[model samples]
Target: MVPDPDLQLQMVIKALSETVSTAVDPGNKVAQEQLHLSIATLGMMRSRLPMTRRFYRALAQDALTLAKDLEEKTGQSGALTQAMNDVGQALTDPGIENEAIEQSRARLHEAITDHLAQIDKSLGTVARDIVMQGSLGSIERQRAWFVESGFEPNADRIPAISELIQTPDHP
Candidate 1:
């Protein structure tokens, strides 16, 4: 999307490195620094995302609560657009070699996804938990849906959660 904001990503990593992971890993400290910076930059940009009142209700809650509270703010589009500019610039940070950062990012995602695939913990979708919990109260709705089809609302929840965990987060 948006022609791969390479520099912006680097900037964002440079921004976030300070907060996400700052350990002295054996693998490329320079890369780590750049990544952290980039993430921090993006986090800062994300702060301007309007933070709608709907979301405010769940501001102190966990991810699931937050997502469920999304009534969609009215004036966030401008903020998101500005954030894109910040992301673009961050992706193109010159402090860290852009080409090397790209390569490392690719490898990193591959490794992370590989690890996620092997994880078998039964934790259903984090952001969807509120919706699922809401459904739990509707036993009649569950039964009716079950009767109409060969699906059960109580089925396959853990697997769903595990997959949700696989979704990447900068933090």
Candidate 2:
């Protein structure tokens, strides 16, 4: 039987915590500091593990939307069509792995980027406007992902990462 990845992570975190508590010297500032950082890092990973699938799924959905919108506006096909088809296939798989979803999102995003470059070369500002508008939702979701880092001055104004991930449109 396959060990659940989430449970494996929890086991690792628990083992690390136990080792740090019993073996690490309290008076050794360097080891203690490293241990603290390691624990925090593990904690962050633990928090994010369950959301990985949802996050990638939503990102894949956003890419699909952007690709469809671009295709409609430009009346074009090629790489965009192929990327859309591939991602659509990936998204439809009920047991799709998170890594597969991430890979699909990356491929779709790359196609979108390449398409945008071509548009910039030929269509100029019009393409830029469409891309900017279409990409805002993705940009907002990425920003929400980092809200916990305390870098955003108006962090309180931003929606929680979970809220952003659970947006109605994505569901």
Candidate 3:
């Protein structure tokens, strides 16, 4: 029987946790430390794997919001407009492949960056706020995913992974 992917990942994580906890050579501190790090990495990957599509979709939505805001400010209709349309189309496709979603997200982000560069110092408060909001949200979401890595001193402030992945922008 084919093992469910999520279940398989859980099994691997559990096994690795046990190995690092007990099976590693106690005298070999470096090996033990490396195994511990590996386990942590695996756990993080397991948490992120199922949410990849949702994460990308949410990013796409955020990019779309930023693009729309920038477009309104610049009043220019070209690459940004096309990028918005592309992302919108990607979001609407229930069975869209990961590659397509990533490509669309990248295009939208690039378009937003290019537009912002062109506007530079003239960007108004509203646009700056929108951009900052998106950036902070993305950073928080990433921190939430990597909290187990013991990197964030204020990890408590980070939203739960489920909360980040279940963004209102996507179903």
**lDDT of predicted model 2:** 0.79
| TM-score, structure 3 vs. true | 0.81
lDDT at position 123, candidate 2: 68
What lDDT is reached at residue 1 by model 2? 35
Task: Please state the error at residue 10 of candidate 2 in Å.
Answer: 4.9
TM-score of each: 0.20, 0.78, 0.81
Error of 3 at 65 (Å): 0.8
Over 4 Å off, model 3: 19-30, 124-127
Runs of candidate 2 exceeding 4 Å displacement: 1-34, 120-122
Worst lDDT run of 10 residues, candidate 2, spans: 119-128
How far residue 38's Cα lies from its native spot in candidate 2, in Å, is 2.3
Candidate number with the higher lDDT (1 or 2): 2
- Cα lDDT tens digits, model 1, 53-74, are 2121121122222222221211
lDDT of each: 0.37, 0.79, 0.79
Which wins on TM-score, candidate 1 or candidate 3? 3
Residue-by-residue lDDT tens digits, candidate 2, 44-124: 777777777777778888888888988887667698899999899987888888898888889888988888777636666
What is residue 13's positional error in candidate 1, in angstroms?
A: 33
